[model samples]
Target: MESTREPAAPIAELDEDAAQLAALGYDYDTTFKRDMTFWGNVALGFTYLSPVVAVYTMFSVSLGQAGPPMFWSLAIAGLGQFFVALVFGEIVSNYPVAGGVYPWSRRLWGRKWAWMNGWVYIVAMFATIASVSYGAGPFLGTLFDAEAGVNTTVVCALVMLALALFFNLSGTRILNTAAMVGLICELGGAVVVGAWLLITARQHDVSVLFDAFGAGDGKSYFIAFSAAALIGIFQYYGFEACGDVAEEIKNPGRQIPKAMRWTIYIGGFAAMFIAFALILAVPNYEAVVADFNAGSTNDPLTMVLISAFGPIGYKFVVAIVLISFLSCLISLQAAVSRLTYSMSRDGILPFSKKLVRVNERTGVPSTALILAAVVPASIILLSLLLPDALVTIISFSSVGIYIAFQMVVLAALRARILGWKPAGSFRLRGWAFPVNILALAWGIIGITAIAWPRTPEAPWYVNYIVLLTALGVLGVGALYMWLKKPYLVGSAPSGDATSQINTIAARPREQVSR
Candidate 1:
């Protein structure tokens, strides 16, 4: 049968967009230009996740902890995060606000809860940018045949940060273009390298993937699996970047949710495929593990690449890896800046007025972009002071992001319990209850796995840094909120809860129509 439904008029769509923004306490004139298309949003999420980069960075660590069998944990983590993404999809479809969790939480719960969510998320994102840039150091060094020492790595990271900032400042068009190019390189590189290694140089037996090989401190296989799951947990999260830029996304209520889920689906497959190929291509898995245990150079993945593709091929692959890394940094900075801009627009953060100001020429949040680069660059300096700064920062980022994510999931569950129903096109319908519960449970497990002290023999600060940092962030955010309660409540547009809801409800029926 021929369809009779007519496409929504452009003016009607604009009115709907404006009404939705107003409901969230925003005006069209003050928000980001809705220039990000569906593919751009997908590219942003994919590049942020950066399967090839993430898998390469953490592959050796997972193998050292649980041998090749750790690949199974990636599958498990992907399943759990699938549900989490669904919950996030539903929220973004209805709200579709920038700042991802912060604004979502504010609408679901209250300002105080949203403030803390942003606090942890902002800290985690800064640490994430630092960690990702630092991880790129080795690959950059290999690509250029430079020494991958601490000073060299730090310098490389700074340079990458500068490039990311330049792209970010150039506006969404250039940034999205770079992201699309990165997506092609990332996926194409993964397929080429993975297929080459798997077909030409597989060294391990198929059954090796199920074998723990006694890697887990003489503990049970489950314990070893838990230890290895950290890589997957961290790798699966960059999909939320789609939501972080919701305001800039066209038809965000529908497209952003689909983009978020597709980010995970594609990213998870790419990560696993590359990891499996690398595992199969290892010439001497035992020696590689032993080198890792002995705290030797942390370039086992590079060695594997060299063995598989020879020197020239290795250099080419390293260049691809560098591209992935740079793209990841760019996506990270974009997400962080948007989040910062969203919070600032709500007058939650210090210097909100300045930070909320977008550059008219570039259509980018200039102050927020600068702040994003400065915070991560400053955090990167910790590499000079700490012996294991890279690992510490990675752990901090993983745990903090998981905590912030779980908070939103918990809020969703709370809203559901209070009879709050989602009106988004991507809603789970009756399935929301179970999905939210499962996602929350999975989040808690993921958080525990990341925070648990893997090595009791390590120094107190090293062993407990993730937990300590999380606590400290929460404490500081709570104190800030408490001290500035009056001002915070008065300054924000959404501060008047009753009026905000009433205003939204009073919007014209056509404007509020889905």
Candidate 2:
């Protein structure tokens, strides 16, 4: 199967893709050129789920909180998220709509249900971009030999955000190219550094994983482990980004589903392997844990990389990490913008018409792309107000994303209970219902694990930021839905779609197909 399913795809194949869209009640969007190949779709998801960026930014948090044993939380998280990914595979296989979560939920449950899903997902994505940008700031500071401060980090974050926006706005091809590059850097860097360190600089024994670094040695450690699992929770998402640009993929029906699964398979492996190798290679494990416990800003990852790769090689690795972050930013921006464009196309947003407009020359959603960048940039400014703003934003983002994902899984389950069947080629033979149930269960568990308050010593707001942010987004969306009534009785498309679904108590089939 060729990755690139060009417009010259067999008439039957092209028709199949278009027919699925038609079944979903949308015409093929000519505004988005179907330029993304299969691997390019995977690249979008992979880069968005960049292992290097995730592991580098989060490794310290996990290690600091729960020591080397925290590494296994990723394995647990991966296994759990695989179930969510499987459910999503079935959903995307059937829906294959742009904006992944938002559009799929819209058709599955209905309009107001989807409005909240898109709102929370979009806000979380912007926070994600800001988080990644801010996380990459210290690396940028290292690369430039600049003092680590608010001004320097903000400048660096803004610069990276601008560059990501510029490349995303340039065109889909360039965006996909950079995404592939990002995938390469993250996967290859993780493997090369992981293997190199494990071979040449291995310091800790396998028993270290069982040691909680004096935090606790009993079942009480479960609490710390769950708190540290945020890394895995955050790392496993962005696979849905493949289906986010469904209209941009040439053979989205088949390819997007495959891409989503591969992203989890490959991306999850890389994330875990890197975390394992980093933990094993820590030269002074006791002292490293001590500094982290002492509230020192010492980066355990930098120390390990410098010890293994030396100063020059450390810089080389930093460059690769920087590229991975920038690439992740680009993919995130692209996915978020496409989601915005998709929702706007349904006339759901404030400036729906302008936001939905695609640039003729580039086939990019220009206004939506700009909005994506602008929102994240505004988020970056908030980092200056809060100490450890990156961590706060990242925590909210991880949980918000979980909340959003679970909403989609819930919608799919509801539609299934209403007699919806898998229509796409990819489906879990007799396992769809069971798998969907497990996925929903896993998602709820993930949301609880990540959103649980770990900062009891901090202010109440900071302690509960993750839950607060999620509730805030949902609250605002619900209020807007009540006040504006965007899905009112006579409104176009969504309101009509909601009516059709509401009537189908026995069979949740689309009106178009009916």
Candidate 3:
């Protein structure tokens, strides 16, 4: 008996998408399976941002630095990031290419700029994976009732990385399903936990949200507030996961932009709500701050959860956090692999041919996935070797990502000034100039804030590590470009529109699937 199944959908739509891409001078073949729908794309962004995971990871640091006032940073960062997202949406709608910033920069500016953008972005993404995995270590330790030491955290982080790689290599179907599951778990966990904490609140005064009780170490409240803003700055990123996987998304020009904006709006609200709930729930804010200042290994969030829900319930929340962490890792790895594959496909990176190869059976970028995993794992191992360097290394995650992002935003602004109008479904029209300028300004401030030396009292090396690391990464990337000149010069669209159209229309349809 022969089994009956509908024939796979014809490649007509895929071919059309390829044509649209070619019109923008991006003539690459569609190697990715367009299995991601609108919601799936949004899920990818949400899981990558992973508010619960981010808040859980940074709560102690932010609370210790700025007390309850740190929660307000979310609103500030969210507004700033919305401007950035607006620019990103316009660009991605016009150039819905894989490797979000890299390819977009290539079309808007030039190859050299795009190559450097990708270089910074790829490094930042690797750091993010390591940081997020290490962040999850405490929760994992809590769940297992294991000691939260350096060695244990390193091991846990490595395990998380390995699991994320497995899911990434499993192909888009499984990965998307896992992302959707993560989105549900993330939303449910935030709402349920937040509502519970709010209902049983210790009722700290509203003024507490503006008080910088922990501002000291020769740092004024303004500096402390800037430091606290790092929490929101870091949390608001990763929404570009939607744009990074644009090739895999259906109706990307229309859907990807919406997904990106929605990711920011929704993720921001969730992050703020959870932060507010946790801040209000703190039975004794000063005590938690003192514990953090005393270098306590226990997470401040753990104390709040224990107070609100007891040991068993706290464990349950830990489990949810673990899920959030795992999903975030998975999303990060997926986005990084696509970015790697995109750069490799354009011959911008070394070992381009090998890195661009996709597994025909699974439609996955196997080599890129492995590369993404190995680099971050090495970073993690490096941190283990020099445990004190962990903070400096992790600092690269947020700063690096923002730098790459702002680079693209700058490129888009330059293009707009030069009359490079968006040719997609989304456009800002009259509002483009002001929004782009604001986004650029905000990004500059953000990069400075994140890289600024928070602890002036500490050793000079420790204080300047973030700035030094960012400079070192860019310097190396610039050196690489100068030495190899791997940029694809003269790749921009030059021929007449009619001729280009004729060329694309004449190309064999089978080429779309190549």
Candidate 4:
């Protein structure tokens, strides 16, 4: 008996999407399978912005630093990130290629500009992968009843990283499936857990959200609040991961922008909801702060769960949180690998030929995926040598990504100044300039906030770690660019949109999920 199968897509709609790619100076017959759907694309970014991982990791720091008042910072930082996301939406809508910032920068400005921007983004993403897996180590340690020390953490993180790479290199089907599972578990788990905590274990009233609890000096609370806002700043990113695999999504211009925006909306809401519930349920904020101030390894939310639901219950929640973390790891690796592939395909990175080769059966850049895992794995192992490794990596990941984002925003604003309107299905129209400017403002403040010296008492390098690491990464890249000039060597044409992006006219089954 013969089997039935739906068409991959309507001929004309496929033609229009292909035409846009061709006009952008790439072959339309891409080896990458257009296997991602609108929801799958959304899931990709949403899981990457995992609420469970963000809230569980940072809620304790914010609460410990600025007391309950830090709850409002989620909205503040999220607004800034949303502005940046809007700017990205405009760009990706017009140029929905792989490597979110790099390709867009290449077209908007030129190769050198894109190269440095891509370099910053690449480092940030790898740091994020390492930091996320490292963060998960503690929870995994808790779940397994292992000793709480650097050795256990590094081992757990490495195990998780290997598992993530396995899923990532498996194929697009497995990758998207892992992301969707992560989305369901994370968002669904957050709602259920938040509501349960709010209903059964509410120890403080909602008004507690206004109290700073003498976080800063008696003079002003600005410094402490700014430091606490890192929680939101860290949480709001990962939405840009949507555009990192544009070539793998059908009707990418339209799908990717919506996916990006939704990642911010839903991810922000989930983070805020969980944070609010955890804040109100804290049985003793003063003691939690004391423990955090004393440099304890245990997180406040974990303590709260143990109080509300005994050790066994806390262990159960740890299992759920571990799943969320693993899911996040999978998405981060996928996004970073796609970026490496995009950069290598343009001959911008070293070993371009190896990284650029897409696996014939999997339709993924398998070697690039391995490269992504390898770099972060080394970074994760730093948990052994540097006691403050996680914090430094977290700061770099947030600040580095924010800087890269603003670079793109600046490029877009510059392009607008030179009279290039967004040419895809989505456009900001008259609001384009205004939104672009707002995004730049937000990015600047954010980079400063995350990179600012929160730990002056610590060693100098540790205190100014974000700035130092970011500058160091860029310094090396600049020297390489000047000497090697890799950008001048690529035969693949740079993406300068010669005409308006070809719109994908309505076609049957265009929105079908693969």
Tens digits of lDDT, candidate 2, 1-514: 1111123322234344555565455655555678888999999999998888889999987787788988887787878777888888777776677788887787778888888899989999999999999999989999988998888999999999999989998898998899888888889998998999999989878999998776533437777788788888878888999989887886576787789889988998999898999999876666666786678988888888999999999999999999999999999999999899878777788888788788877888888899988998999997888887877888888888888999988888887777776656567768888988988999889988878876567889887877887888889988988998765422323422224432321122232233
lDDT of 1: 0.81
| Candidate 2 collision pairs | none
Clashing residue pairs in all predictions, respectively, total 0, 0, 0, 0
Q: lDDT per residue, candidate 1, 1-514, as tens digits?
A: 1111123334335556655755555555433677888988998999998888678878888888788888888898899989999999988887777789888888777788888988899999999999999888877776777885898888888888889999999988888888898898998998899899898878887888976665765556677678778788778888899999887876677898899988988888888889889888877667766766688775667778888889998888888988899899999999989898888767778887788778876778878888888988998887799887777788889899999999999988887777666766678998999999999999999989988877767888777888998899999888988988622543334323222353342233344755
Cα lDDT tens digits for candidate 3, 45-121: 99999999878877888888778888988898889989998899888887777889888888778778888999999
| Model 4, global lDDT | 0.82
lDDT by residue (tens digit), candidate 4, 1-514: 1111122433435555655665555655456778888888888898888888888987888788888989888899888888888888878877778889888888888889889999989989999999999999988898888999888989999999999999988889888888888888889888888998999899999988987765664435877888888888888888889999888887887888889999998998899999999999987777666666777766777768887768887887888888899989999999888888888878889998788877777888888899888999989876578767776778889898888888899999988887676766678989999999999998889888888787667888777878988999999989999999988876654445333442231112233211
Runs of candidate 3 exceeding 4 Å displacement: 1-14, 28-30, 386-390, 489-514
Q: Please estimate how well model 3 matches the true structure, expressed as its whole-model Cα lDDT.
A: 0.81
**Which is the better candidate, 1 or 3, if ranked by TM-score?**
1
Decoy 3 TM-score against native: 0.92
Comparing 3 with 4 on TM-score, the higher-scoring candidate is 4
- Which segments of candidate 4 are over 4 A away from where they belong? 1-14, 296-298, 493-514
State candidate 4's TM-score. Answer: 0.93
- Of 1 and 4, the candidate ahead on lDDT is 4
lDDT of 1 at 30: 37
Superior by TM-score: candidate 2 or candidate 4: 4
TM-score of every model versus the real structure: 0.93, 0.92, 0.92, 0.93
Q: Which ten residues in a row have the lowest lDDT in candidate 1?
A: 1-10
